[model samples]
Target: MSATIVRRSAIMTAAVAASALFLASCSSGGSSDPSDSATGSDSASAPTGVTLVMWHQSADADPQLNLYKAYEAASGNTIELVDLPADTYTTAVQTKWATGDRPDILEYVPTPQDMRQLNMSENMLDLSDLAFVGNRVNDAGELDGAVYGAVLGPLSSFGMFYNKDVLDAAGVDVPTSYGDLMTSCDAVTASGADMVNIGGGSEFPVNMFAGFAYMADYNEGDQWGQGVADGSIKVNDPEGPIVASLTTMKDLVDAGCVNSDAATATFQDSIAAVYDGSSALTILPSDFISLFYEAGGGDTATVDETIGFGPISAEKGIGSYSASPIGSYFVPSTGDATKEAAAKDFIDWITTEGYQDYVDEAQAVPTLTNATTPDLGGLYASLADVLMDPSTTPAFNQSVPGFGSFGQVSVSVLVGQASPQEAADTWQAYVDQAIEAQQ
Candidate 1:
């Protein structure tokens, strides 16, 4: 299945009820730059000599650990950083919360459902009124007009990662729009290489198509997203965005831009196909630059020399947009006042002048205007420009509920089990059912 589908399962797994636990503990981790003075309320104080516990998934090697250690030494309050394993972090956090043991600070992705479950507006400390709030690009952590979380560092964009060597060898330019993509695909294919490795067995292609479709209708997504949330929008509607998106998917497939083994290939298989020089492109998030490198199991320098990322819109003239996650941080109100204040101060420090360092460490686009990112050459540089654009929107699937079903519907369309319209309608039915159940 697609990473979206898999991640959704990861969200709901253990049980729908158990998902409550997962949401309660969801967040992101980051590294910090200590040279710049932290900016925020100086009055926000921690209990002297107290060891504040923080639950996060940031690796030990991240510079944030050192920064926190510095905070501990300077303030005389110990920050006991708990590095939760990726697979069990959600469960562990939820279990701790269930047992009435909550961390002082939480690093998570603040999805709508999770926000509701946590009663975020009421329970999480309101960061909206803080001076640090001014550094944010948008209120991604806002729920019902109250900002409950701090989005750590930067935004990660989704796009196609190309094997630069292969594209160069085939005389293919990096695709900037859908038309360019098709032309590039044709050129690459004519050169006897797979145009792109589509992990059709997974929801990956659907993910890319969703990015394209979402960019096409981005300005209207919030309205339709609310409609979906309230049962007014259905995927199967004749003129719905869902149907339009599915049609785009079909067109890409019919154009013969996809690999022949797409219907059977897994994500890892697609990644390997590109690494071995059999394919030119694979749609993925920017962070996957490292993942692709690690997957290759080679020296980092060699991988950096081979791969790059670029944008692809649904049409010829429009600039491409990709969905990005605003990694969120929260200070739970369940803790004591001293702990809460310290957590707030820690988070506030993260948004200050040196925030760019954390973002660079994460290989993401900085959320702060003053922050700088490393110069990633080639297609990745192009994608970074798109990300820096003020008009860009978050990915649609991430914004709308019930969007995960598109992956399965996409698979059906690929296998001839359903037409694009049929797939759209099926997804609509699923959305309708979900809406009714919520009612």
Candidate 2:
């Protein structure tokens, strides 16, 4: 999930036209920079007054909220913040759109399905004019050649989070390959502990593994993805790489490499195992480094030294990783032009140097080129090298569709309700169906 820029070629002509229409309908008409003196000045000094409404679903909202307030104060505009609960944000937004009462600006992750559903090319603001969203060498949120949203910052790479104390006590080297991991599982379990704590109740992790497998076995620029997109690849295609990946995951469970209670555990519970020293590893994002340190009741310094990270190792060749933008702000097709302008201003300000500085200070990565590194107690710095080269190790979870189903598959495989082959088959089936629906 490391945020590396990716270059995609132009889409078909039909896609381009559709995108153009979508952009036109959603156009809010304003400069991409919110902090421009002309846009931020008081009404007495500026051309007109504007009001904006924004919706966001991140767990950490205070920093953004305060930042928004400052933007409003400085720009002399009225800005309203709508904080949606994480679980319901998707449904809520859909409902708003269905009711024809969309927010002026909203945050969304632009998955392929999302692109198809929103027809975003014709229904969202064209952010290509913005420096942060447009200037990146690889623009991730673009769909069908029309950029919909701006990424918040660099992508966070996902990998196995291990407890050094547990691994050391078990005499297992940090695993560098799938074979090594399988061998380490035996020693970990012989120590009377679970090798990995998995949250089977959730679906995201299982889907992540499926995606990772696809990336690990194939080159990033290959036709596997296009095949999936165009209905040429079957989820249960007998000869597909998905089956092998699922088999590996199944092998892990069959060999007692993961917690037996994984099927019923919630995400928090699984993560708690690592913090409490009951398990050796948990697949998660780099941001979790901060959370783990805080949860262990240790200061940043202690956590930085104690935690270690590396890419997911492969048996032979390198592995590719997947990542998505932190959700982005999108202006709707039906908002008032003035409000839309205001909304765009807010987006511009948030991605600017002033806001990125705040993000850096908060220890979060910034998307802008001039972004300053946050003082994250050296946790991020420790893993910086690994994060940058994730694709060279194990595949990331982003390359797959239906990423939400990861946990369910993990649970099924762990509990023996499904064999590795069966799980892989089911996952591929689901992904194939999803891809078809989008098409």
Highest TM-score: give the candidate number.
2
Candidate 1 to truth, TM: 0.71
lDDT of 1: 0.60
In the range 1-439, model 2's lDDT, one tens digit per residue, is: 3222233221112223323443553464511333442344333332235677676664433445566666666677676767765434555667776776677777765544554556686678887776566434344566767777766643455566677878898999977566777889888888877887776655454544444533454534534655555557654565666566666667887787878777776556766787667888776655456567666675766655555655563364243432232335677766466676666666666666345434544444444443433434365654444434434432333344554454466457667788767776776777766666665
The clash number for model 1 is 10
lDDT agreement with native, every candidate: 0.60, 0.57
lDDT of 1 by residue, 194-305 (tens): 8767777656555665544335334323445566677666657777766665666566678887788878887667778787778888775553455576666846667667
Q: Clashes per prediction?
A: 10, 21
Lowest summed-lDDT stretch of 10 residues in model 2?
A: 6-15
User: TM-score for model 2?
Assistant: 0.78
Taking all chains together, each candidate's TM-score versus the true structure is 0.71, 0.78
- lDDT at residue 361 of model 1 (Cα atoms): 54
Output the lDDT of residue 144, model 1: 76
